[model samples]
Target: MSGPGSAVLAQLLAQSAGQGADLLALRAIAEEAGDLAAGRALARLGLEDAQAAKDMAELRELLAAWRAAKKSLWKAVLGWIVKMALVLMLAGLAVKLRLWELLE
Candidate 1:
């Protein structure tokens, strides 16, 4: 009943029961309730500090760097696999064509 929203709700109920309701008072109470709810939500998300935005940006940058490193590593591995396949194919062609005897 002490909370702003509850107080406003109680006032509404009182008005319904024939008491005169003040529009500004009800509006102020509702605004206070909305502000309190927003504050609580920010606190719950751990973003109530001045440094929270900076911390979030750093985390995003770290994630992007990690993803780039993983992509580069995969590309390098694929390049090596392709090179090995080419070497093997050339070796098999040389053996079939008796090209080694030509070098003697």
Candidate 2:
């Protein structure tokens, strides 16, 4: 026996990749694989139709969150760089105005 759990999972994945396997089929495969693997199941549990949709929803949510976080981080970095540039430009302007004397 080559581990029925893995064999079933592989078959499920293969079936899922095929053109004919729709969402319902994929959920069926998941449920069957979960049943066969029992305690050793590698994926999500639950056989409800909504369960698969929930998984997809959660994945989308995570992706959206990651994108938002990435955008925020870039914006923060850009803001810091702009702030630094403004400060430097103001300092240069002040020096040129002779408001602050530079001692060499």
Candidate 3:
């Protein structure tokens, strides 16, 4: 006989057809399947919910870290490019005035 969790999963899957299920919902269903296969129930469902929450929290933290790193990298690259351009411009002016030959 199917359990309450199976009923819930079936309903969620039906409702989510074509649009794709939410990550949390899919996690819950996967946990439910494991528990059902193992002949267990509520405990596994609760554990699955906790796991899903933890996963979401971790994902958010990672995304924030990535964004911060990307911003920092872009800033550093832009600063380096600006500095290099200025150095090249100065070098060009020095060469035009024969300053480079004097140093040689």
Candidate 4:
């Protein structure tokens, strides 16, 4: 429809899969129909669909790296805690056995 009063854009989208609908053609139709709002909507919808179809592998990889970093950080903290505990236990044993006096 080439008139504002003609076919509504929302109705068209609801009725069809928008497979054959071209953004440029839709804009032209909306312009000729004096409906800039519909033209903008059509362009926005087309761009959104285009972006959604793009590959997201980089996003997935970044998420994986973040998860790995979080895991590694926790492991390092736990490792440090274990090492400190062992050192403290060894010192306690030396004090209980009076090993420092023997060193003198």
Candidate 5:
């Protein structure tokens, strides 16, 4: 059955059923023959590859979200520092002007 056509392979596959056939070997042969079984196997492989790619994409998205959150946290902390500095400056100005003496 060297270089058998797809139709012949299909016929053989149909005939081989329940005859204790080695389906793995037949699948390999079908791959060489470019038969329907090979097409099915390749479709399964394609689905697996697509799933892997989707997982990678999700991981990348998670990483991007983490980076954005880190950047936002730094910005909030920096803003807090500026606000604290401004408050301290205002208090120092009041003390310099002797405004505290009026509180007595």
Candidate 6:
């Protein structure tokens, strides 16, 4: 009830109010039409029920959990790769210095 259509309806209601008792029917029709439009819009948006808020909240939480899991998975993979790289570097250095021969 805050857009151009509502504004026009408000203006029409005001004009009808000043026109006299004969326009009361027109006023009632306008109000009914506004209510019907609002109801239809709510229906279209699938938000006509009390559970809509709870459903939206659950969806948001599910999305956040998915994002968190994805982030942690990437972090684990990167950490593993880094650890492997470090181990390989250390092994390469030991081979270059012939450290295995010392143990032989």
10 residues in a row with least lDDT, candidate 3: 39-48
Clashes of 3: 0
Candidate 2 error regions (>4 Å): 1-50, 101-104
Model 5 alpha-carbon drift over 4 Å, by segment: 1-48
Question: Which lDDT tens digits does candidate 6 get at residues 1-104?
Answer: 68997788778777877876457787678779879988899889998899988989999999999999999999999999999999999999999999999998
Task: Report the CA-based lDDT of candidate 6 relative to the real structure.
Answer: 0.88
The TM-score obtained by model 3 is 0.50
Candidate 4's residue-wise lDDT over 36-73, tens digit each? 67567767866334454353566678899999999999
* Residue pairs in collision within model 5: none
| Residue 90 C-alpha lDDT in model 3 | 96
lDDT of 4 at 16: 49
**TM-scores, all models, native as reference:** 0.60, 0.48, 0.50, 0.50, 0.51, 0.60
Model 1, range 1-104, lDDT digits (tens) per residue? 68896777777756754655666676677679879998899999998899988999999999999999999999999999999999999999999999999999
Task: Kindly report which residue stretches of model 3 are placed more than 4 angstroms away from their true locations once superposed.
Answer: 1-48
Which of candidates 1 and 3 is the stronger one according to TM-score?
A: 1
* 2 versus 5: better lDDT goes to: 5
Cα lDDT, all candidates: 0.87, 0.76, 0.78, 0.73, 0.80, 0.88
Worst ten in a row by lDDT for model 4: 47-56
Report the number of the highest-lDDT candidate.
6
Better of 4 and 6 by TM-score: 6
Using alpha carbons, what is the TM-score of model 1?
0.60
